[model samples]
Target: MQITASTVSLTVDDVAASRAFLTTHLGYTVQAAADGFASLTRTDAVDIVLLARGTEVLPPEQRDQHATGLILAFTLDGGLQDQEKRLRDAGVEITMPLREEPWGERLFQITDPNGVIIQFVEWVTPDDV
Candidate 1:
């Protein structure tokens, strides 16, 4: 099957809080929203759907599960440092400091209001490795 689009649905304790965090800080626009759900989208990133914990739209077994131990990562083409600084300057707490790995991966992380861990990464050639 050919996939046309991608989306990740996250169940959170507070849908509005996660919605606002993504829209205001992470550049996601609201595609749709309801009392206990929100669909967010971005031109350069994956679409996100936030559902309040216990929302009936989810399967019975998944309704009460909050997104935990999950890290949503986005790989950037460039400007990883500038983006990190921009978020920091905008008052977003850098949950994980930006660092480069020996494998040529540079990354940093931030946790949204609902505790969703979002990580941004950029790859570059590491010298002497």
Candidate 2:
């Protein structure tokens, strides 16, 4: 199948809160929004759709489900440390402190207002690996 773009839909307790967090901290712009739904977009990242828990647009059985156990990760080419520092300087709490693995992968995480885990990763060539 042909995929032109990608989006992750998150069911959240407070749609507006998640929406605001994406816009304010993650550089997302509102493409569309209503009382219980918001579509956010950024040029360099995946699109995100926030839906209030129990939103009627979902199937009856799925309407009450909230997003959990998922990490929305972005893989960057470089400058991960700078991005982490910027986030910290903006008062964004780091849920997982920046750490590098033996395999040359560096990553960190932050939880959004609705508890969605947003992780940033950068990979390098490990001389030993």
Best lDDT among the predictions, by candidate number: 1
TM-score of each: 0.95, 0.95
Candidate 2 Cα misplacement greater than 4 A, ranges: none
**Full-model lDDT, candidate 2:** 0.93
lDDT of 2 by residue, 90-123 (tens): 9999999999888998999999999999999999
Candidate 1 collision pairs: none
Off by over 4 Å in 1: none
Model 2 superposed RMSD (Cα): 1.0
Candidate 1 lDDT by residue in tens digits, 1-129: 999789999999999999988999889999999999999999888899999999987999998999999999999999999999999999999999999998899999999998999999999999967
